[model samples]
Target: MRRPSLLALTLLFGTSIGLAQTTVETIAEGLEHPWALAFLPDGEALVTERPGRLLRVDPQTGGRTVISGTPSVDDRGQGGLLDIELHPEFADNRLVYLTWAGECDGGNATHLGRGRLDGDRLADFETLFVAEPCVRSMKHYGSRIVFDRDGYLFMTTGDRGERDRAQDLADHNGSVLRLHDDGSIPADNPFMERSDVQPAIFSFGHRNPQGAAIHPDTGALWIHEHGPRGGDEINRPRPGANFGWPETTYGREYWGPEIGPDTLAGTIPPIHHWTPSIAPSGMAFYTGSAFPDWHGDLFIGALAGVHLAHLRLNDGHVIDEERLLTDRGRRIRAVETGPDGGIHLLTDHVNGELLRLAPAAR
Candidate 1:
């Protein structure tokens, strides 16, 4: 189970070598914007295609079977079937949580649902949470699901392109929200007593946070969010913390205009920042025995850059970065350590491939 360090892999092969240490094989093809992936108890994977199809992907054999009864998805720009996560007690409860953009009363809304995984199909799906009062814009529906150690569900939602709404507690936009397993707000939330900020708001001022996970050693919530043009950030979330968005950033407007002053003192600094925008998506900390030396390293999937970025940290500061999959030229969407200790990836492309990364056989 003891595998080689990424530093060792790099030193051994150097830049002249491609990602042969990581082998990518097509597990399924013809997927329309495959966004998220989750493992089943049976060793297969459930993949969510952005156009609203869910497939049970068999990693071992590269077989795919479409799961039935998926809810209708609003496939607008950057909106559709999004992140999927399994219930904490999935082995016994068989529950799954999903995020998608769905049509509400008269407009579009972000919907979170739960269902039972039943033999390659989703059954008894019920709406667990819905971003209230649907927004008109179909963009920026930042939806990712995470569960706290205590089993509370933490859902991150975007401001739906309405920047002002992020400051409005009544609106679900641009906020990290916490809810009970069945979708009720925990009274202990920072804003539970305030009527303006909804009881669910865990933190505010996030712009399109797509990657979220718990740090293995610290157990703190960590998030990766897309900045306007150049500044993509890796942030550690905390209660009542304001992560300055429109007000501050190292990025500029997409139109090539300056956003705000760069050296603002009050704005929270990113633990790590990527200039020129890698368009980061999938993020997870490496803890498996496959790479014992990389136990606390952070693995990030880069879409625009079409690479897998490894951030090596020492005492919480990023000291080095290594880019893999440059030769493959595929948008890496999700990166996770597999049950077998190999790094598994669900790529994003016309023909996305599932990849496994380890040290090249000794």
Candidate 2:
């Protein structure tokens, strides 16, 4: 095996922030458009390739083994195997959940499923939820999975390029969904009693949310979505709230026309937004002690911007922002905090790389 490359540098924020010496190590390379990552109990990780392969990766050696039993996926456009997550009680149940673009009657839709991890393969894989009214469009499959503190699973769905569907409560597109671990709807779901809405919907009116993470302190779900020309946003989705996609956004059409008012009377406003579009992807809240200054900060992978965004938050509001890996120019796809307190990132490319950011030796 070849030795991994290491780059040592110091990341200095503004004058008030502390300068931290950091070292970036290439853990693995040649990953084919890796999308999401989940670490196992033994420090190995599961990575999902957009083309429908699941790989168990050894971070130390950069070796990978393809795990069998992944569901067939629609790999055209932006659709394919997406997010992977371990069950909250994974140590006991060994259950793994996944979100992917699966074939449907009309075209394809984002689907959620789970199976027990049985050595190198998944056993008894089952589909739990499918975003309804699947359409032909392959863009905007906003699929990210996270589990709340109480053990309920939360998943996001893009509008599939149909902006109107986001405003329709009957459609599953462009919404955050909540479900029990077994794929059943919870009784306290915001739309349970509403005959006109999808009962699993927790929030709606989102465009294309590709990143989601739970707040380290509040345990609230935080998600970010793409905008057309500008207006990418980070929002803390609330039950029964409308996020206002086409009807209300700070973005303009690709051809240069305003979508709508940035705010409306009834929709929930974003806590933070970006104009000119960073094209944010996977997200994580830094709770590790390796980088004390980054603890409690939010990290977002930026695809279009080609960097990792570090956001300092105060009471749910973003106060400062910094960009990491800007010199590397990699299209960051996923961001995760390793068990050892290092930050792990997956770059998006045909021959992508898995990189880790840790404190440099003094």
Please tell me which predicted candidate would have the highest lDDT against the true structure: 2
**Candidate 2, lDDT over the whole model:** 0.91
Q: What is candidate 1's CA lDDT for residue 105?
A: 84
Clashing pairs in 1: 158-174, 159-174, 169-197, 169-198
Q: Pick the candidate with the highest TM-score.
A: 2
lDDT of each: 0.79, 0.91
Would you estimate the TM-scores of all the predictions?
A: 0.91, 0.97
Residue range 1-362, candidate 1, lDDT tens digits: 22232122222323323433433444555666788888887777888888898888776666789988788899988888988999889999988889999988877888899888888678999988998769888887878888878888888887787777766667778888888988888989888777777778888877778888888887888888887788888888777677777677778888999887654665577888888999889888887897676787888999898988988888778888888768767898887777766677878865666666765555
Tens digit per residue, CA lDDT, model 2, 1-362: 43535334565444125666677888888899999999999989899999999999898788899999889999899999999999999999999999999999969999999999999999999999998988898889999999999998999999999899999999999999999998889999999998999999999999999999999999899999998899999999999999999899989999998989989989998889999999999999998889777778999999999999989999889998988889888999999999888999999999988888888777
TM-score of 2: 0.97
* TM match of model 1 to true structure: 0.91
